[model samples]
Structure formats: structure tokens, C-alpha cells
Target chain A: MTDSSQVYVREVGPRDGLQHEQTWLDTADKLNWIEQLGEAGLTYIEITSFVSPSWIPALADADEVARTLKKSPGVTYAALVPNRKGLERALLANIDEVAIFLSASETHNQKNINADTESALARLSRVAEEARQSGKAVRGYLSMAFGCPYEGKVEVDEVERLAERLFEMGVTELSLGDTIGIAGPKQIEAVISRLGRMIPLERLALHPHNTYGTGLANIYAAFQLGIRRFDGSTGGIGGCPYARGASGNVATEDLVYLMQTLGAKTGNDLVRLTSSAQWIEKRLGRPLPSSQLQLSKEEGRCL
Target chain B: MTDSSQVYVREVGPRDGLQHEQTWLDTADKLNWIEQLGEAGLTYIEITSFVSPSWIPALADADEVARTLKKSPGVTYAALVPNRKGLERALLANIDEVAIFLSASETHNQKNINADTESALARLSRVAEEARQSGKAVRGYLSMAFGCPYEGKVEVDEVERLAERLFEMGVTELSLGDTIGIAGPKQIEAVISRLGRMIPLERLALHPHNTYGTGLANIYAAFQLGIRRFDGSTGGIGGCPYARGASGNVATEDLVYLMQTLGAKTGNDLVRLTSSAQWIEKRLGRPLPSSQLQLSKEEGRCL
Candidate 1:
């Protein structure tokens, strides 16, 4: 089981949040936003993706983002690397951490990265090895671990098998992404309990989207089951571009408020986090879907 | 712990959902809305408040609303009764159940009902007795059980003492209201654990507001601790009139989606419930905050 005394929230706003939007923020705006998030007391951030710019034009300036981030002391900046090429780019940018991705469902894996489950893991295994040899921490993301838009009701055993393989391949952490947010507390408990038998709970993190409004509840269920690390986006940005009407990742302020109120030590300051969410939402020219940010601003309370 | 296999969702759209709104729904609209809710498979519904018209002019048509209801079989239709006078009105309207309200915090009690804590309980005690004599189910609500807007954090012992008094006063069910939505899972666990020792789990229910976006999380926490009954409003209507930016009860669709997805039988049809939410939201002439309702309409999925 993971540590019960503390929780680490990895802010994925710059990468996960920005990737799904129709609008794009230039490199300068991205830099300013990332700096604000860095100052907001995030201990770990998924800063950008090193995948081909042609694929993710929104984060096309991944190299610039990695190099320009005024690396905050004690904060780990991680970037997603699809393969050896992306890993080399990350190495050039001097990234703190590199992440590789696969999926529990074969259909989702093929649809997401144009590879079968085995082929995707094979690619990530090589990348993970090279990234570890290069001395950068490696994180693995198992997308659609709960349910897939292409394949509904992902099996817990499949997730466990994939997770074990990722851990064996030198991934320091495995983030289970509920890509379409179809997870409920019961399913979360069942999945985490099954995975805990194969992997140390501390090496697992949960990244839930709020599609059915069960994101926070699912996260809380995981927390109670002793998973400490969580992935959230500021202002609740980034829905699954593949799933219709899927909302963004659970809002950072909402998660922070729940964790803080439950007496969990999250180090991140709520006031500063809200300001950063507000700033980004303004830049997006629309209101973000964060309830805590809205309440904290409208009510003027220090929640 | 409460039973995990089955959950009861008591819809409070006509009462709690509409009470805080600036716009008023006439008796005909209220009747139509309540009928829609009843037909949508809700086993329990809080129809209206039978308080003095001056106190809650929004629900001033309580008598007419109660009289016109089609009265679905096997459904418990309830109304809020502030005192003996209100109970008498409910009795005349042949309400299936009558609910009484008090506050765990004296300041909130005074501000909300213009009575001190002890005085409000005294009044409710008489109403509970009268309703019991008339063979009507009685529910007692303890507002601000988690926190109070006027007086910050409320003590667990204070809530325990209040719940005990309400249960002793012949209230069939006791609802602990997170009036300001300041509750976290730890506080919910602490409070429910203490109350569980004094009262049966079946007699206890949770009424959470989504002010801090902890509403569903709190409900999930309570559900994990064996609470089987919950109170929610359609389309997540109404905010706390006393607390700034305090949202309505956790939306019925959100709660239904969660419990149903968790494999707990709610006996409420998700598709029909969502249509009711959309219908009422249209009546209100604005978007309601229910993520489930919004997603169902936009995604065209039968959640």
C-alpha cells in the first residue's frame, strides 16, 4: 500500500490539459502558464509531451517548454516520450522525468497510438530502459484502465498484467488513467486491490477524468485504498478527445480542497492554484470547469 | 456499516432544489415537475415546505403542490414542516411524510429559522409528535452538521447530541446536512462513526451541498461507511441562501449515476431521471450544475 500520511498530486495541466483543446497557446503563453503552476507549489508536473509536433501541434514546442521552464527547486518536471526519438528529444531538453504510455485495452491502444498492446509495450519497454540508463525517472501511463470508449468495461486482470509489465520494464510509477471516466468507487477498489497484489501501491497513481461526475469519488476511493499519488489538471482542463462529452481531469483545487479538508498534507497552496487556473482560463477565453476555483473567486473565501 | 448492495436516493427537487432560487415556479409548474420526478422512478421525493408563506414565499404554494400530486404508489412523498402549524397544514394536505429542520450550529439555526437551537428542537419535537400521532413518517434534518457559515467548524459531539435528540423525538429518519459543503471524508467518517453507535445506520441519511465540490466525495465516503440513503436535487438546483456560492444538494443524476455504476440498485431509471432534470432545468431557464445531466444530453448516452 502507498503512504497514508501524505499525497502527491502531479499537475498535468500543461500536457494533458492543453492537448485536448481546439485553441492553442503559443510557446510564450505556455511558458508563463507553466511558470505560474511551478510557483503554485506543485511537487511534480507533467510539463509537456516529446511526441512528434505533427501529431500534437498544441504542444509542438515541447523542446522549448522543457528548456525554458525555470525549474523550481524540489519539483520534478516530467514529459511524455512515445519512443526512442521522443526520449532523445527529452534527453536533449534535460527533462527531469520521461513517461511512456500504453493501454489496458488493445482496441484503445491501437486507436490511440496505432499499435497493438504488445507492440506498444515493446516500444515503451525499450524507451523505459534507455530513459533509465540516461538517469531520468521514468513514469508509465496505462490509459483507459477503467473503461475505453472503443472497448467498454476493461478487465481488472488485464490492467494488472499490463501494470506488472510496465513496472518490470523500469517504469518508476504507473498512472492508471480512467480515460473516459466510467469508473465508480466499487470498480476502483476492485482494480486497485487486484493490482496491489502484483505491484507496490506506492508505485501506482490514479488519473481520473470527471466525465460521469465520479472522478473525485473514484480518486477518494483510491486514496482510501492507500494510493498516494494522483494526477490532476488545473481548472479541470483536458477531456478525452476520443470520448464525447467527457469532462476534463478532476480539478486540482477541488482535489486539494478535499485532501486538505481531510487533513492530508498536500503542500500545494489553494489560493495560488486558483489564481493560476483563473489565469489560464482567461487565456483560453472561456471559463474553466473547476468548482473550487469558481467558489473561491465568487465567494472570496480561503477554501 | 450500512448495506452496500442497495441504495435509496430521496429526490428533493421540488423542495430543496427550488427553495433558494430567485425565480419562482408556480403551483402548476411545481406539480408538473413533481409528477415528472415521480414517474421517473424515484421512490422518495420531498414535495415542498409547509412553513409560513412569509418565511419561504418560494414554497408558499406548498398546500396546493401537495394536494395536486398524483401520489405514485410505493413512493413516499414528503414535505418540510417547521412547527405544529406546518404539520397541521401537511396533515390537511395528506402528505405521506413531514420533515422538520434544525441546525447543529445555534447561529445558523437562529439565522435560518429565527429560533435558537434548543427552541427550534423544542418546536420540531411537538411537530414530530403530532405527525407520529397522525401515522405519518417524520424526518429530522440537522443543518450545518459539517460546518456553519455564521459559526465556522461545528463539533462532532454537537451533531451527535442533536441527532440523538431528533431520533428520540420520534423522527423516523435523521439527515445530517453539510449545509455549507465544508465536509471532507475524514469528518464524514468521524461524524458517521460516532452517530452510528448511537443510531441505526438505516435511520441515518446524508444531505450534502456541492459548495466546495466535495458533495459527491462526501456521499461516497458515507456510502463506504455503510450509509444507504442519500438526499439529492434534480439538475443540482438551488444554492445555500445563507452561504455564499454554496451549491444545491448533490444532483440526483450525479448521485444516481455513481450508485448505479457502482452496481448498487437505485431503482431509478437514469434516462428518465435525466429527462426530468433537463425538463426542470429548462423551466428554470438556465443550465443546472449536474455533470451527469449535461453529459447525457450532449453525449446522447444512456448513463
Candidate 2:
């Protein structure tokens, strides 16, 4: 079900990354950074989340960001929408796609969105249907699919159940998130291979965090299993606000470098991708977690 | 030729990591840190390098460290010996093993050790023989085996040639180093698969840097190719001084995590290993590059 030769990297830095950051880039800086990411050949970018400002003040200007940013041809600008209100706001802003998320573990679901698994699914189902009816694609995110901080070692059957429900709700793709970054290659293989029996592999993407430094290896293991889509933050600058010790998502620059070295086409320019990371790092006023960015800063050149 | 059920983790932090560090720990701290490492279930540790004080002032107390560190029951204490003089010092210290290194690329060899490849190999040939004759195990490190800073992509043919020569010199095992941390899964697959045809895979190890963030993935690729031995630093603290932009080695805690997840026995307690990393991080007065260490510091517990 996967394209054996190509990888689709979805940039989540502007949404997932910024949401957890203490430093807030202004709407203008966010727009400019998103533009730089697109110019670096990232075709898919989750630009913002249409959640309540009180919940995530860092990305409070989601509507403004989505409506005002100039959309590039061949680039899909997505947004995370939590509920019907967020979806309405997203549709108003003409967002390209709407991503809805729930956790595989019940405790994590309640902790993350203040809803139990069943209610969260019911709510996301409505949101998914509404977004689809509005002629937009819906992407589902199953966080803590690997291991839950509250409930350790999420069962693969539970993951499959949630994933199937999302797919049944008319979602085109399901991104399995290692919310705490605890999954390794064995866990990736076990979960993805089990899930592959129930769904098309192409419809699945990996959203891995580098918390335990196994993100890339886990991604590689999934790629070997015919997974083609991956989620990465530009500077590896996002983690679950609820998952303690969860570090940044795998950096987009490092992901591109890994894909390129593995002989897969990601349509990303490494130098430009690294430069975009640098731009965001400078605005963040602290070093980002991406190894490529660190190397570039150290040597004053893209490796 | 390969052990499918076990992973040999060789700790190179004290030698390779401390050698590049800006802050030099006193000899007592180095000894204490190394003893802690051995107690944490690391069976092999390259404690320090017997290089000139002028070359690496940080590890100037190499002889003292090699002599003073309390050896654990199953631990093999090793040191990097540059030549006959270093080997003599190592022998006098009763080092359990002596590691000799040269670069696979001529320019890197010249820049790293101020000697050409052929001459460096010639010098190491004597060191390897002398170490073996002295009844200590001999380890050979081939730096820039993946990619070189000045030479870019290193030819696998050259790697094989150099590797065969080192094996001919009676070294027990050869560790191929990604000095710049630029190689990824494909390069690892290509180089290691080719070399496996010429030499026994069990006699080979991977010394990967996390510069480009593909260190664990590269190690995973090598492991899949029947490699069991890996070189890592406790806190991911070391890089090649000669290779610009080179970052830390793959963290020992992270490596153990990966290997354990892959169903291989590394005999390491992740908590103890991470605590050791934190211990070193404090003494260094800054964060080490290990993701596990960072996560532990953030969560106040080992992930």
C-alpha cells in the first residue's frame, strides 16, 4: 500500500512544536517561518491548532495564521482541530486539512483532552464527519499508541480498535504517535505489523518523539515495514505537554537526511531545511533539539 | 559469525568523549566515573587515551586513570594507545585491552593524528602487535569509515582494505567509526554488508556519532546486518576534534535501550546507566548530549 521509493514528511513544528514552547513567536514570525519551511520543499505543514486560547496560548492566533499566511502551490497547510468549534473556525480559515487526535490509552486521553476514550472518539467522529462534509480531508492522530506515561505499554489491540474507529469516521490517514517517545524498533514492528493487517500501510504515518533517542531507529524499522509517511517538527521542538519528560519530535532536517541516505525521496532540500530550522532556532532564542541544527551552528555550514 | 542474542556495548566516553571535552575533570573524578560505569554493567570501557598531553590535555592523566580505576569482576578496562610509547604506558598500567586507531581517509588521518594513513597504520601495526604480545586484547578503530569531513563519502573499498590490514595485525576486533556522524542506514547497509563478506561480522563493531542524529538508526542497520558489538559514550559526550561539526557518540544508555528493545541482551540497567550519565553531566557543569540523560534530568527519573 506504500510508495516504496518516496517518503512523505508532515511538518508539525508550527502546531505541535509551538504549542509546547514557552517562547511564543508572533503571528508574523510564524507565517514567515511556515513560508521558509515550504520553500525548503516541505509539502505538508500543520500550521496551527484551532484550540482554545486558554488551553494553548502559544498558538492562540491559529485563525489569523491560517487565514493570513500565503498558501504555496503544491503545499498542503493543515491544522489540528479539537472539536466542532475548532473545526468551524478551521473551515472559516480555509485550512487545507483538519487533524483530530485522541490517545490510545484511556488515562492519557482523559489527561490530554479531559475526555475518556469513548467520548473523545464520539466527539472526534463528529468533527471528522463535519470536516469531510466540508470537502476537506480528515487526519486522525492516535497519541500514546506505543506506551502511555500513565498506562505503560499500550496494547496493540487497543491501538487497532482506536485506529479502526478513526478510519471508519472517514479519516484518510492515521498518525500513530509515540507521545512519550518510549517505543523502540521492536515495538514499532510489533504495532505497525499488527496494524498493517487491519489497514493499508500507506494510510498510516509515524509521529515519533526523540525522548529516549530511539525515534529515528523506530522510524527506520517502520520504513522497512513499508511505512512511507512520517511526522517531524522542523527543529524537533515539540513534545506532549502532559507526557512528562517527552522531548521534541524527531527533527525534520534529520528525518530528511536519514531518508535521503536510505535512498528514499522526500522532496526536501537538506541545506534549505537546515536553514529553516536555524531561522526558527534564532527566533526561539535558545538552541533547538535537532542534531542537524546543532551541527550547522557548530560548523557554520549544513552537514 | 554473529551473535544474534547478545549486543556487546563498549563504552568509549572516557577516552573518546573526555578527550574532546572543554572542561577537564580531575583524575579522581575520572576514576570514580569509570568505576561507576563498570558497576552499571558495562563490561568494556576505554577509560582514557594514552596520547600526548600536548595533543589532548583533557585526558593528560591517562596513565593515572588507567592505573587507578578499580576494575570490576567482568569488566575489561581499555585505553586508546597512539603508538609504541602509549602502548608501553598501557602495558605498564596493566590495561585489560589497548585500542589503536587510524583514519580510513588519508586526509582525516593526517589531520587527526598528523600522520598519513599508511604510516599511521604502520605505527598501529606495531602497537597492535606489542599490545597482543603483552597479553592484552587489541582493538582497532578505523575513524571516518563512513564519511570524512574533508573527503566526504569514504569508499567502502578503502574501509575494507584498512580493516583487513588491521585484522592482519592481530587485532581482536575492529570498530568502524562514523567520525562525522554523516552516514545513515543505506551507507551502513552498503559498507557493513560488503565488509561482512570479507571478515567475520562478530569481529566488527560500530562506533557511531550522533552528529546527524542517525547514530542509533545506523547502529540498528548494522545490528540487522549481524553486528553485535557497538561503541558508545556514557553521556554521549565525545566527538572527533579533527572532524568539524562532529557531535557526541551514540549514548550508552540509548544504545542499551535500543538493543534491549531489539531483544538482545546488553546486561545494562537503564536506570543505573542514566544515573551515571547524570553524574557525569553534573561534573561537566553542563548537559551531555544523550537524549536519555536529558529526559532523565527533565523528569527526575529514568525513562
- Total residue pair clashes for candidate 1: 1
* Stretches of model 1 off by over 4 angstroms after superposition: A1-3, A240-246, A299-303, B1-4, B240-246, B299-303
Cα distance off (Å), candidate 1, residue A256: 1.3
DockQ of each: 0.43, 0.49
lDDT tens digits, residues B1-303, model 2? 445788899999998888877887999999899888988999999998888999889999988888777888999888999989988888888999888888898987777778888888888888888778788889898888998878888898999999999999998899998877888888999999998998988899999988888989999899888899999999888854433434578989989988887889998888999999989989988667777777765733222
Each model's lDDT comes to 0.85, 0.87
Model 1 has an lDDT value of: 0.85
- Give the best candidate by DockQ: 2
How accurate locally is residue B155 in candidate 2, as Cα lDDT from 0 to 100?
91
Q: Poorest 10 consecutive residues of model 2 chain A by lDDT?
A: A239-248
Model 1 Cα lDDT, one tens digit per residue, B9-70? 98888898888776788788898888888887899999999888887789989999898888
Cα-based TM-score, every candidate: 0.95, 0.95
Docking class of 1: acceptable
